[model samples]
Target: MSSPSPKSPELSDHSKKYDRQIRLWGEHGQKSLERANICLINATAVGCEVIKNLILPGIGSFTIIDGNIVTEEDLGTNFYVEKEAIGASKSECCMRLLQELNPDVNGDYLDESIDSLLETRSEFFQSFDVVIASNIKEATLKNLSNLLWDYNIPLVYCRSLGFVGSIRLQFREHCVVEPHPDNKPLDLRIENPFTTLKEHLAVSEVNGKSPWVHVIHKHLVEWKKDHEGNPPKTYKEKNQFKEMIRIAMKSDEENHEEAIKAVNTVFESAGKISSNLSAIFNDEACQKLNTKDKNLQFWVIAKSMQDFIKTENNDLLPLQGVVPDMTADTDSYIKLQSIYRQKAMQDAENVYQRCLNTLLNIGMKNEIISENTVRLYCREASGLRFIRGTKIQSEYSDWDKSTTLAEGLECQQPLMELYAVLRAYDHFYTEFGYIPGESYVEPDTPKLKGLVTKLLQDWNIRHPVSDDMVYEICHYGGAEIHSISAFIGASAAQEVIKLLTQQYVPIDNTFLYSGITTETATYKF
Candidate 1:
């Protein structure tokens, strides 16, 4: 069959189907989503829910690893497994049902245990983009976490137990060029306009029809003349600057109003290097860009940007090529937009060349970092983020000595108490052959309390887990409620999407959700 052209109607329809999300993350992010291959460790209720959310968004494919068979309990808690699927392989049943959500998504399942896969065919996991594990034992989870951490693949470990759920993201390092932060101001560079922008503004007239950029530039030029060639630097001066704009308004012009509103932010540290970006540039990874590892692409680009800032760019980050909408004539708006767009393209091209030069010097392929990727990185350079994550196994091994946990408990946070109880539950399950509340809630309450007490003592924490909290957990009996599972499933899937697309910032390390109070918290351990 012949391939569809770029203007094909079929491609348009495909884009239209995901138009809403495409608007959020752009076409490149959508392509990343469609190219991802997710590995789900178990087909439990929460696990299937995570898969459902990812599949609906048209992920490339998924592989479910499970050795259990579907049972009556699964039908009650899990939405993917139907009643007729009883006695069938749980992973296979889930794969068949979930594939029905999006035919574009491919899926398969191994009716084998994850432990067996880890021991016998561990390399099979190398192909996946992200791994989601649910309802896994601590011992097995540690092995898997260690393995994936060594491989530098992100692992979304989550559990939905009764009314509470938690997710811990484990990875070696992750970098984001686009964090999609809200209320990012337009980088107009009015304070320090480039040659083209200065030429455009020099000829532009300030009137009711003028764009806000011109209006602000005109008033700013006048303000600088009267204030010793300086913009407003103090709070009172800024307010006075706004007053100047308000008093100079010939009428109730929208552009003038926008100028007054923009006075506070437009001149506030324009063309300054943010502390976060400065930190990124100074990071060891960015400093040591001579390595041959392809994973250092973000740092390599960052190093190139640093060099650009130091040499060619006059110590300023790349210009973000975007402008705000305001009341203006079509010609005026187009002219202003063109000036900024051209400057941005020039900056991006400069950065892209530096990246190519660095890659060649480091003995890597120049094509490893494409022009489009560099453009995207330069466009979102101000909002770039880098996260270095610790393994889940380390969290477990050092749980008792965690000062973050200690401080949360000292503050009498309910979620902290829940965290302790969950740890105790894990200890109970490992020591005994069953979950604490699996068969009997009343008899196991004391045992769970004892385990929590021992943990606190070992950690030397003075805060105590109350009896009521223990009873509450015992009452849950380790049962998986669909509502809680659904909530956690959606949250986990969102984090997975962030990881796959490398767009928005994922949680720093851990996220805890409590259905009882309808509140959530993020913790970095």
Candidate 2:
């Protein structure tokens, strides 16, 4: 396991500040953000907004470039600048404001436009960890894109108009673009064993004596066992409770007996206890409600529960004094405890969504064809202006229809299993757990001999492996998973974090915007 990050002086005082987000991205992700250095080419209003979000998370360092002074209009929309600072240079003002959000960040501001310096300097852009150009002219966009691309540096291109915004991210190579080795798929990491139990408890239409309701019903069973199988607590709490039960139990004492009233009272009391516990478990305080608050309240609760649940080890009474804060009674404790389990499930779902989103968005951000790869191919053969590849074929095949990896490989007719192999390589590095230079099967080699035999039998192609040619096809011909639409920009930023910090693998080359509709398919490069 990787050692924990050294306690940074930049820690926040609040625990709940990012509670919901922390559950999604985890503390390691937050630390990855802390160690990133990002560059903003033009600090426009939209750029400032993106920076505001980035700064709050305390991205490692920022270099902002702009020559324009802040105008009065900026005060209305730019959250980082004040009305009084209208005449000041926007870059410096934004830098100062961002630094106030987190003292750990080191921000630099340039009072001159990016255009003026580019004419005489080529090394200026090389200083940043990642380059993000916001609201720049199209010509400048192309120039910056080319510069970053030539240098193999990751680039983020963004544009905004009114409510609509577009963002693009580019990572130069697979090694730098992929996720960390330790990261796992969000879904697998969060599947819970107690889902059915939690769901049954939450259901209102359950039979009173169902096996699923045992957690609550067991209270009665335990109480009865404690009272020598005679329900002594009910008798002690209320004589009416026991007398009515006794009368109801006898065959000759049922003439106008009010047993229903006694039964209702007992249920009402149990219901109250259940609600109290539910309140505590569902409590906003218990959820650690904010990521901005970095006080680690969840860890505190987890630690306390570790101790509180220990009484069960000694076979001692648990419900008497084992109540969580604010859950004073057994019913409340039970309900809150149930809520806690539900919240755990919710937290896991959120993490899965974040990871899934991040995986897809990385592809959308780098929607450009690999110019370097194209150039390499061009050098091998003269007059190769048009490369007969899957991406180009798909573009001309239908009116924006998605292409499959198998089809792409068929069209290319390469000397190897190009697309399939690339996918395997991508999966191996990102989610399937494989690293380069490690002793194992050839990169992208089938994991099982049975599957290999089956695929070879079906495809009628058998090739011996453990060579570099297979690895190249697997790495390059693979599809990219793209995250599109509303989450485009956020996903771009997430990918940059992974690339810069080497904490997460980049997503496959597939742009999926299922938000508009559940229609998701492949986008090849």
Q: Which candidate is the best by TM-score?
A: 1
Candidate 1 segments whose C-alpha is farther than 4 A from its true place:
1-11
Estimate, for each residue in 1-525, the C-alpha lDDT of model 2 and write its tens digit: 112234846546543665555555567567767777778877666566556667766688898889899987666556678887889999999888878887767888988888886766767877666787765554455567667766656676654433223445555443321222342111110112134434544553322212222222333344455556543344354454445344434443321122323333433322112232334334554344333322222222322232332322221111211112321233443554455445444433333333334324433222222332222211111111111112212222232332343454445433223323332333344444443223444433444233333443444444433334354333332211222222445655665665544444454433333332333333444
What's model 1's lDDT at 81? 93
The number of clashing residue pairs in model 2 is 48
Q: Write one digit per residue (lDDT tens) for candidate 1, span 1-525.
A: 111224634558788889888888889889999999999999999999999999998999999999999999887899999998899899999999999999999999999999999999999999999999998888899999999987778999989999999998998888877888776756788877888999999998888888999988988899899999888889999899899888889866988888888887887656677777888988877888747454678888888888988998778778887887777877788788788888999999999999989888888888778888888888888878887888899877866446887899989888888888888888888888788788888899999999999988888787898898898888888789999999999999999999988888999888888899998999887
**Most accurate candidate by lDDT:** 1
Clashing pairs in model 1, backbone N/Cα/C closer than 3 A: none
TM-score of candidate 1 against the unseen true structure: 0.96
**What is the Cα-based lDDT of residue 10 in candidate 1?**
50
- Backbone clashes under 3 angstroms, per model: 0, 48
lDDT of 2: 0.45
